[model samples]
Target: MKHEFDSAFHPADIAFKTLKLAPHAWVPNNSRLPVLIYRRAVDPSTKDLGKTFEALLAGNEWLPQWRDSIFDYHHFHSTAHEALAVISGKAEVIVGGPGGEVVSVAAGDVVLLPAGTGHCLQSTEGRFQVVGAYPEGQQWDIRRDALLKEEIAAMEALPFPRSDPVAGRKGPLLQEWT
Candidate 1:
């Protein structure tokens, strides 16, 4: 089979050729500017985003590393299930539970959270490359730093993550809050 390259290429062909697979290693420019190498067009082929689920690319948005201190630490909600697929570079995916317990995720890893769960990220290496998803009617509720700090304190006060084994606790082994 021979494939021809055209300035006017179809999405299906492109997605297929790339195997629609996550990048082997998530490497981003030193500036942390995300590069949109590929994106799944919203068309008839891909319309359904099951209940409490969504899929969208987190395109590289211009942000001054020095000036943009917005994404320091926060937890947002996406009415529906949320998934972040690492395309390149190392990113720290912190999936926080009712308590302070957090599960740490690394590059080339896909982190999924139930609807209304608390999740956030702090780029540990390179630029953060991730594809985020939300339920049909869900919009990202980005919490402010002050709010996040309060939540962290609230969660820590109560022994939650440590109380339950089922609670999904992942993120950096030890994050300094002070």
Candidate 2:
């Protein structure tokens, strides 16, 4: 299928980081799945950054769920994993609950959070717009706290996506998740 930006032509050697977050306080961050972070996953200079990210993720079977700024409070999803692409400005985001990893993201960067992983916005520059997505069959739930058994079970039960939202079939999500 021809895409708007040819699937947002990204670099073959797109650099990424994977974090396996342990449970923090009441937040049951994923024990089995590490959050995936891709730096410069797409070209920031594109005329239409959000559209590029949407098409790329859609092609990979991840739905372009919403376009907004990250929530200012710490929270997480229990039912569905999430993919976020920065389309405007920059942000300092905290992932894996309070005192979790603090990441700085800018336009063109992408973050894939496993179910039950915590995330919140710390601060931003410019417009701070983000495009969020979810795997094809999974819908998201906001949870700041969860019963250990229930949250862990729900998170563990979720299936890993077939392809990486940014890296396509060869994206790190497949290898690391499985």
Candidate 3:
């Protein structure tokens, strides 16, 4: 799991914003960690955006999980944190929950969500898709409702990733997530 990233492709030019979402309705937002959004993190001109993200994320130890469109339903993962890197098109994403903040994301945008944070797709402009990853050794489970105490505990129990998925060691996540 100690693989180094091929420096041939880099996503070092990132403009990130941090937003802390409070526990809302059925969404048990992370109590201490703020979500990270990186605008234009990737190079839109890259021929294989998905492959580039996979290499970048995997190098940081947030192993790439899937390449697909976001589910258009409010849900959260209690087992692990998630990173979504938009590879194509644009979309309006609900970041926190039903009454949470909404953001417009396009190609090259990346959103990092803490465990227990709610998310779903609101709408898309074109052929929208993302390459997602999670912290090493962490698995994921989809929960439509965060109604159980065990779920909350599971989310709170997870630890922060050692490095930012996109930026690697000196990433903004280290500065902002804590």
Candidate 4:
């Protein structure tokens, strides 16, 4: 029996270029992470969190970062299942669980975390990149400070409403989410 491996197969090199040779650009401040927005180069139809339950369950993986910057949690998938494929770059994927290890996933490495896992990413040296997947019905939960900033900016941009709810206009509703 004979097996064949590509002559140019280097784990580090492979990781660095998996998502290379593709058109990439700087993400603007207003733009959220491409993964959560479904704007990355991958198949958007298949990447929806709600419909692609199997991918979420089976724990699909991919390059999670690129050559420039890491994806921001506020811009990435929120409250959804996820898997990661580390082709290159250096980073961490910390999920919530007992003995949840902060695995050092690098080139030719794979890791899977359960749904609703809080994610924070940072790049080492150059740009860090990885492939990732998530379940649907996900939302970006803004931090308390970030939410306050947005609310304040929004309020400053507009005149106060006639009903002034925040100004002690008690309504019939108790809690919104409930």
Tens-digit lDDT string for candidate 4 (50-109): 223223222322212212233443222223324454434556643221222233444433
| Candidate 3: residue 42 Cα off by (Å) | 1.2
Model 2, 115: alpha-carbon shift in Å? 0.4
Minimum summed lDDT over a 10-residue window in model 3 is located at: 1-10
Where in model 2 is the C-alpha error above 4 Å?
1-8
- TM-scores, all candidates, are 0.36, 0.93, 0.91, 0.32
Best by lDDT: 2
| CA deviation > 4 Å runs, candidate 3 | 1-13
**Residues 1-178, model 1: lDDT tens digits:** 2122222212233221111111111210011111111222223232342211121222211111111111445454422234454444454443342222233333333343433344445446665454454323334455322233454344234221111001112111011111
lDDT of 3 at 154: 66
lDDT for every model? 0.29, 0.87, 0.85, 0.28
Q: Write model 3 residue lDDT over 18-41, tens digit each, in one string.
A: 888999999988869988888777
Sequence-dependent TM-score of model 3? 0.91
Q: Score candidate 3 by lDDT.
A: 0.85
